[model samples]
Target: MRDVQWIYSHEVVARPQSQQPTARIPAPTSAMQTCGPLLFAACRRRGRPSPADAVCRCLVIHLSARHDGTARRGGSVAATTKPSRLAASPTLPRVPIPTRTRSRMHLHQLKPGEAASLPRHLLEAHVVALVRRCCPGLLALRAAHARLIRLRLPRLTAAFALSKLLASSSSCGAAPSYARNLFDQIPEPTAFCYNSLIRALSSAAGAAPAADTVLVYRRMLRAGSPLPNTFTLAFALKACSIVPALGEGRQLHSQAFRRGLEPSPYVQTGLLNLYAKCEEVALARTVFDGMVGDKNYAAWSAMIGGYSRVGMVNEALGLFREMQAADVNPDEVTMVSVISACAKAGALDLGRWVHAFIDRKGITVDLELSTALIDMYAKCGLIERAKGVFDAMAERDTKAWSAMIVGLAIHGLVEDALKLFSRMLELKVRPNNVTFIGVLSACAHSGLVNEGRRYWSTMQELGIKPSMENYGCMVDLFCRSSLLDEAYSFVTGMAIPPNSVIWRTLLVASKNSNRFDIVQSASKKLLELEPCNPENYVLLSNLYASNSQWDRVSYMRKKMKENNVNVVAGCSSIEINGYLHKFVVSDDSHPEIKEIRLLLREIADRVVRAGHKPWTAAVLHDVGEEEKEVALCEHSERHGSWLPALTGNATTMSTVGVYSTARQIFR
Candidate 1:
């Protein structure tokens, strides 16, 4: 696919006017657009790069069929181009800026706080310095820098004079006004000059700088300047990616194709990356298919990852396997995408296959892959297996330990998780913000109040700052233990603002304790934080029903309908001997419905005999609690579990439930 996109390049870029003798440009005008911006402007000037000793403007960018004239019509030139360290384009000319000095009267004429304004002389240097940080693709700057360039530069003085009026201090970053003034003097800028400006504008952070990159693209187009090279397009694409300007991206890509740039690996990669981010993986694949060769790894990875993220795991795996067959060895990024695909497919057997492959191929298992595997095993109901992998790791980062701890906590092994956390401390593996979340979760899952307090105080003792999630977890732990006022005081005295998740956790804990006022408060806050979340409304209605307020419950239900909130469907999933079966409440969609019903009936009788009562509040949400117990006994996982028990050697086997939480086990 990559090979197909290459354009015939027999000395493609034309030499600048100041160089190769046969040059007749017919002056700059709209007619220049016929030839495209990169070439036309790139063709215009043939001179030494600015600061002749340094290669300031030797760059060539390609856009493919993705980024449009956001540099022109749409107002952006940013693409999130996957940066690669490669030599700069040889044919491109270097920037050769002239010296200039700012007059004292110009300094007097300058507006207050206008120092950062750019000067033409320093424009090439200042922009190079600034953009190299945000986007490092511009290799020309590797040799030159701002402070190294002339400090009393003429362009700097000119920009300084212009900044006295046209610009403000904040507009120029650390660039001086003289550099800003240089921009006006060089009315007929070489592509190097334009590249510098594009680099600076394209790199401006956030939406504001994003908008500026587009304006610059447009200005170049209006000037009948040649389109930017693939490198320039890549930078602009980064901005478009940030703001998600698809139309602008598409236009730039088309312009790139027109400029005969479809073959460049950089352009194709950026196109695929941008398209994937927009949830356009199909389009990204189309771009990937046109890549020239192994040069398009970024493009392939982007498309594969986009598919994997959206749950098209089979397709992602297929592409990766195909890449392998083609001998395109997977890099760390490629492995990350494939590992994610394995997780999404719930393919634990396949995960083992990958692990074996990594071992046989001598591929180092990175922290990311290890973490994904931990999550995969946990989700697959293989907690022991997950632990084995976690313990055997050569080295572990905070996230790796956090993933293992969280996996254990979620699987009803809180003590084991905490024990591993203790090991982490003994090994001097410092915990980050995420470590607290895992620890707090362990406490919540195990109903360990005293242990939670001790660990929490120790957290402060260790100088760890508790984030909002930590606070929520602690509140839920306390509330679940029926420590109502303690939970209340903890939440009210939170150091950070609580979000809806925190409120919802508090509300659920309050519900278990029958704390009506706290429930009301938490629900109110949840509503404010998540106004569109219907669960809060439904839960509040359910809470009123719990207290026997049928009228209030009915009113809440009416409001639900008025606001278009629907009850979330209940779902249960069970993993049995490597196969997962899902059961939705009241759903009879499985193949062996008759057998499932029989197993569920038998489980209900046994659960009741074992003292599992019908749910109370739900029974009167209009039935008797007795009838509700019948309903509880038939809960989805219990039903799903029965099918597994029926298939296994029932009397000899203990049902091991793979749950997202310990409460699920109790349920």
Candidate 2:
């Protein structure tokens, strides 16, 4: 049969035959009219009449003839074709064509039993475009997917189309499981398909989705057809970071190295972030240094944050300086890390400078940055300044409120902390675990045992599970209120095992209350949990010494030697002129150490004259009385306090002011 081109319009117009005027077919019936253009276009594009064409042709003839058995326009049809079984069927449901997509019908001939061999690229492109255009929601996506299945296209074509569908479904709020099922339908899933699913699941909330992302990446690797690319490795590493699947992350790092993707900046950053978050700072730094060129903000931020997490404040600040010298602009994330380091070091002067720098440089002090500033100021003994930052924030989250509340609690403003917590609840802001920690700490500070218990019950009512920190706070509350029996009972009744911190808290309280029996028990538990901790050994040894149990004291010292546990020197930091100066017990390294010691002796004489006696019981060693007094005077906190007084920086005055005021009053 010869091929024919039909131009659809209000009237049916056919291409002219040799020596024949263009034939006009009468209009189709209402039922056929609705589907006429679609059926004719499909048939014409295939270049031959299929069973659908027979139905289309028969419908046209049956509807075009008048009721009197006459052709309305006196038009003669070329052939009278028998209708297929579907010819008399009801009107088919209309498939809405996207307004943006135009029809591209071609008149290509195919042999009998041969399917259309669409250009692979063109077919894939068209199907992908169609899927994206129609899939605005899950329902629309599913409809498009069903239409694709009905077309029975080749496997690769269908896979390409389904890949787009998978991407859309994952993004349009479809569950991760739905995307996984959709991906399984693809016969040979492409790397793009796997990458899309992995990225979506990794970014989704909850552990299960993140785990699914790793599983999908693993399946992609095991399939061995489409190798995991840089994107796949990066996303999988991100999931590992969230899950903290350090073991899996290590395997992916090795895989990246094997695939020569270690050089990729994306892969390097992913590896850096994974290791940084997992607290493998050494590995994170290794990855960071291995990068070929200048590090970006993300790399710098991750490395700095790793240092802050491990309490390596000096390293974090030093790297921040390096980042600045490198001419790299620090983003909010980098500033937050730097601020946190300053908080840990009590570098108040530096923290203030960073805050000013943020304003001077026009960097956005978002909620997170503001919250960090609050924490830094509060920890630096500037609670008022912390409150200023908290109040200045345009919007506050649970973290911001918690930071302020905790700051107040730490500063011994127990009533204020409780008041702010009440305001938070009045505003309907949900309090998280950290908030309760602050609240409980405030209660502990003021010996509000009943209030502490009430808040603990309230936390449970709000579905906020108490973390280890919360449990420790509750134990401290009981101990501080002199509820020794209750504190012990609480520790015994804890749902989770009591850690060394809890045991240490109980031991300190027992020692303070002179309950030697409880002290012995707590000391035993503390030693069992943390035998290498010099503080625990030193604490027990001091108790033994105070009670005149010289043999037990000797035994404690001997056990310390056997365990190779050396006591950690007490250290204190004071910030002056934007510089952090640290001093350790008996430290004489400062250039002005002789002058500081001379001034300290003069102040000690005045304090002693005013009946201020040193508490020599803190010295655990069997030393002379004079030697114990000397050790107390040489403490790091005393040294740190005198330096700020010597510098005349009133902002840093703390213990020094007490000595100065007492001497003046006595004189």
Candidate 3:
């Protein structure tokens, strides 16, 4: 469709000016209406008083004469064969007569100030025509911009024209420096000029950052003229959202409210989004609840998204239900937030229902929505379903591919994840940092040390810096493969200081590998990094006890008591239907706690009968073996792991897998 439109526009440009009707353009038909403005602009471009202006002046006079029947009676007027003004300027193509119908507007109707405005508008239209010939490129725009400046149009005219140039340049993906320089030349910019510049900067790459846009808005305010309108407020809020400036955004919200602009859905939605991105969910909800009359999907979606972004899944879900109750049909944005909440809460059933709703309602599955769906399915432990969603996507972006890869990697489909990564590279889909994290994590988990190194090198070669996650993956890969010394060296060799997680990973792996040298060093570093984290002391004590260093174990326990440190008890949750039920270690808060405990005991007995002895070393307390086994049974993860089987819902398998991983970590 775009190609066809481009061809039509090009055909208008391709027609030579000489080939236009040589006969005097008759009667003010729709096709001839814009000739006056186009000719006037062209004449000005060829110098202030060129012969082209003389010719156009004569043509308009002749047309008026003919219209009033002052010319030869019943006779047609003909253009003279004399050398034409356009003949000297073959480069200026005849302005295509716009085919679209327009309301009657003439140069005569415009006031003195607006007389300059018409020529500038027509000039921009001509420039737009030229830009089409060299579009998706900046050269024509650069030339047009230069010509406009040289013309020295009136101040207001120039600002308007420069604004158009800036917009065109940005739309063509040109370097914004030219536009920025052009904007700086405007002596006193109007509201249109500021709005255009702000909008362009908001969307441009590597241009002024969002913070700069807010500064520009502040400058506009300081100008004290050209008070901001709806457009200005919308763009300003967008800039605030991008920079995530909660204070400035809230201030703007108040200003807009005082100005009575909150009634405008555009301002309302923009303000809601600003609060959402800033993670001020409560304020966003206040804005949402304050909205009067019929609410749009965007306003509701923004509020729900605010909740989802801050990991308040229940609130997001509740809002989704309220939105439905209000008969505000959910759009793609709403669904994305709701699905994300499901992913966070591990609500596979609700996520699936939303997915089906999308299909049933025939909602457009854009890249973002599709990516969210993949993430939801993968995180829900329906990895194959996630892969299916991924494969079926007609247009997959980096996020889509990364979600699938990460999902597969976490679910222990290591080889499958790597294969997809290879395929992604083969298809020339440039992998991002997230993609590398997934691939490297897959390698680390599968003990593909050499493979992990190769990917790390590939990432560097691709100019992708290894982030903390990447470093963690490498350390984990070494540690998992029992290369404690190498892991320690890698940690030391890191360009940035290792976080406690890195040191902790090494400490746990060292104890497993019986590397006392690394265990002591890593534990000391962990304690220093997180002085009050009870896990560090507990881990050190466990290592000492494992090696029968009873005195050192006793000393570590004493230090933990002196510091008043307490371990954060493990907890797990499983989502049934749409509600999440969480269990804490030795939890007795649930009304069904007795039944759950009995069920866990029964499962533990069945496990023993199946010749699967519980790994009890994770119980750090010095207790009898039977007591340690009892402690393992009372663990929250052990109880949560039975939800899928007892509830007869296989969809909660992801919860079980999570429990297994946690159990393995302790083991």
Top model number, TM-score: 2
Worst 10-residue lDDT window, candidate 1:
73-82
Question: Clashes per prediction?
Answer: 79, 0, 0
Error of 2 at 390 (Å): 1.7
lDDT of 3 by residue, 1-667 (tens): 5744443333334566776546544555544444655555554444444443444544454444435432211111122222243332333223323311110122112233443545555544543454454455677777766665555557656666666776676567665466577678777777887887777676655424466677777788899988888888898788778767777777778878887888777887888899899898877887788777788898888888889898777788888888889988888888999999888767777788889989998888899999999998887778889988888999888999899999999888998999999999999998899998899899988899999999999999999888898899999999989888888999999999999999999988988877878877888888889989877887778778877778898898788789988777777666666676677876698665677678878888999999998888777777899998888778776566665566677563444433222442111
Q: What C-alpha lDDT values do all the predictions have? A: 0.62, 0.77, 0.73
Model 1 score (lDDT): 0.62
Q: In model 1, which runs have C-alpha deviations exceeding 4 angstroms?
A: 1-224, 239-272, 275-300, 307-329, 341-347, 378-384, 408-430, 443-466, 574-582, 586-589, 593-595, 602-635, 642-667
TM-score for each of the candidates: 0.60, 0.75, 0.73
Tens-digit lDDT track of model 1 for 282-382: 78888888788664466667877888778666678778788778777666677777777766655555566776777787766788878877877776567
Model 2 regions lying over 4 Å from their true place: 1-99, 103-154, 165-179, 204-222, 586-589, 606-612, 645-667
RMSD of 3: 9.7
Residue 603, model 1, lDDT: 64
lDDT of 2 by residue, 1-667 (tens): 2223221211132334573445555655565555555555555445545543554554554564543212211111111112223232233222232222211211112122222365565566556665766656778778777766655667677777778888887567777777878888888788888888887687676766556766787788788879989988998888888877788889888989899999988999999999998999999989988998888999999999999888677788889889989999999999999999888777777788889999998999999999999999887778889999998999999999999999999889999999999999999999999999999999999999999999999999999988999999999999998899999999999999999999989998998899878887898899999999998888788778888888999999899999999987766666667666767666788776677788888988899999999788888779999998887778666676777667777564442211111111000
Off by over 4 Å in 3: 1-140, 166-180, 204-210, 227-233, 247-267, 527-568, 601-616, 622-630, 643-667
Regarding TM-score, does 1 or 2 come out ahead? 2
